[model samples]
Target: MMDQPNPVRVGHKGAKVSWRKSSYSGSNGDCVELAELGNSVALRDSKDRQGPVVSVGWRTMTTFVSALKGGHMGAGQA
Candidate 1:
């Protein structure tokens, strides 16, 4: 069995965050948005910008991004 990742539970639902989606996301807008909040970074779906947000430490965020770039994880999207 694979271990599940811990959920980022820093921010609450509908929190106001300055999020920026990836440029490669294109105009389709089906992308994830990220925001920098002091020592933490927040992520939310572009399609639901006003929805729940996940906040993780900057180091953790960078690690996740690195893993994504290295193909260690998947986007889980079509």
Candidate 2:
């Protein structure tokens, strides 16, 4: 079995985060957004910009982005 990664701590209280939705996201209401802050990457719901943001390490974020591009998140794969 694979070990799950621990969630990283984030300070979204006053973060001047610049959120951007996924290019693959269409006119649909379901979409995720991302932002960069120092060595961390912030993730939030595009529909809820004012909601909570989750932060992760740069390396982890890289892996996530790669997986996303590879359609590992069930975005394009049928």
Candidate 3:
């Protein structure tokens, strides 16, 4: 699986990363931030900038998003 999170801190690897969140996110500060890391994507909590970051392959992220949009995985569907 490409869903495992990298154990290093942000910018620790000296790679340039710009974190951004979905515009649909509410102003209540509940969302996740994403950064493009070459062939992979990095995800972090918007509320915890210094928290853990999960990195997944670009293709994996794309497929995951597609599943969400297609309603393949839902509340009770694993």
- Scored by Cα lDDT, where does model 1 land? 0.71
Stretches off by above 4 angstroms in model 1 are 1-16, 74-78
Q: lDDT of all predictions, in order shown? A: 0.71, 0.71, 0.82
TM-score of 3: 0.80
Those runs of model 3 whose alpha carbons end farther than 4 Å from true positions after fitting are 1-5, 75-78
RMSD values for the candidates in order, in angstroms, are 4.7, 3.7, 2.8
Worst 10 residues of 2 by lDDT: 1-10
For model 1, give the 10-residue run with minimal summed lDDT.
Answer: 1-10
Return the lDDT, model 2, position 42: 76
Predicted candidate 3 versus true structure: per-residue lDDT over 36-72, tens digit per residue:
8887888899999988988888888898899888888
Pairs with backbone N, CA or C atoms under 3 Å apart (clashes), candidate 2? none
* Clash tally, candidates in order: 0, 0, 0
Q: Estimate each model's TM-score.
A: 0.68, 0.66, 0.80
Candidate 1 — number of clashing residue pairs?
0
Model 2 misplaced regions, further than 4 Å? 1-15, 71-78
lDDT of 3: 0.82
